[model samples]
Target: MDTLTCHPCPLDAAELARAGRDDPATGALGEELAARHLVADGCDLVARNWRLYAGELRGELDLIGVDTAEGCVVVCEVKARRDASRFGGALSAVPPRKAAKIRALTAAFLREARLPYPRVRLDVIAVDLGRDPVLHHVLAAL
Candidate 1:
C-alpha cells in the first residue's frame, strides 16, 4: 500500500459512526474467523462484540474468548484486505485511539457482565478474504 491508501481511518466521529455500522458485518466475519482460528489453537469462545454502558459511555468489544488454560477475554478488531501488504493490510486499521475505545469496552464488559478473568488482552486479526482466506493473528497489538 502507498501513502494515500495506507493512511489510517479518520478517528473523528464520522469514521467511528461508519465503523460502528460496518463493524457488524466486517467485524462479525473477522471475529467469527478469529474464534475459529483461536479454537484451532485451543481457545474457547466466550463472547462477541462485548459491550458495556456506563451512563453515557459506551464500549464495544469485538471478541471475548478464552485461550488455553488461562481465563482470557480476547478483545479483537478485524481488518480484511484483498491483497496482503508487507506490514499487512488492516493491520494499521486499528490505531491507538481506536484501540483505547476497545480497551475501555473490554473493561466495561468485565464490569457489566461480572465475568472473572485472570488476564485480559487484545488481538487484531488481519485477513485477506479474496480467493483464499488468509489470516494473520497479531496478539496484544496494543
Candidate 2:
C-alpha cells in the first residue's frame, strides 16, 4: 500500500469545529487537503469533484489523479471526520456500495474522457480534523 503523511492546512481548527459534519465547507477543505497531498506524493490531479450521469446511475468522484510513475488513473474518495474514532474514522467510512458506485463512475469517466492509461486504481483519502489534523491515503482501497 502506498501512503503519504500530510501536515495540517491553514484553515483554523475552530472554524472547522464549528462547521460540524453537515457543513459543506468542511468537506471542501478535506478535498483541498487531499488534493495537495496527492500532488506532493507525485500524482498529477486531473479532476476534482467530477460529477457524472449515465442513464440512471449518477455520482461524483472526489478526486481523479494519475500516478506519474505507474501511468495509472486513480479515482479517489475522500472522507472527512471531526474525530477519527467516531464513525469508524474516515478510512472505513466508504462502504462496499459506495465503492461499487465509485467503480461505475470511474468506468464512465474513462469512456467519456478517452484516457489512455494502462491501468486504473481506487483510492481513499481520509481526513481527520481533530486537535491535530491528519491525512491518510489508502491506495487501491477498493
Query: In candidate 2, which residue ranges exceed 4 Å CA deviation?
Result: 1-22
lDDT of 2 at 94: 87
Runs with alpha carbons beyond 4 Å of true place in candidate 1: 1-27, 83-88
lDDT of 1 by residue, 5-52 (tens): 121222345433433354355455555566667676677777776566
Q: Per-residue CA lDDT of candidate 2, range 2-72, in tens?
A: 65545564556665655365647668778878898889878999999899765888999999999979888
Q: Relative to the true structure, how large is the alpha-carbon lDDT of every model?
A: 0.61, 0.81
TM-scores of the candidates are 0.67, 0.84
TM-score of 2: 0.84
Best by lDDT: 2
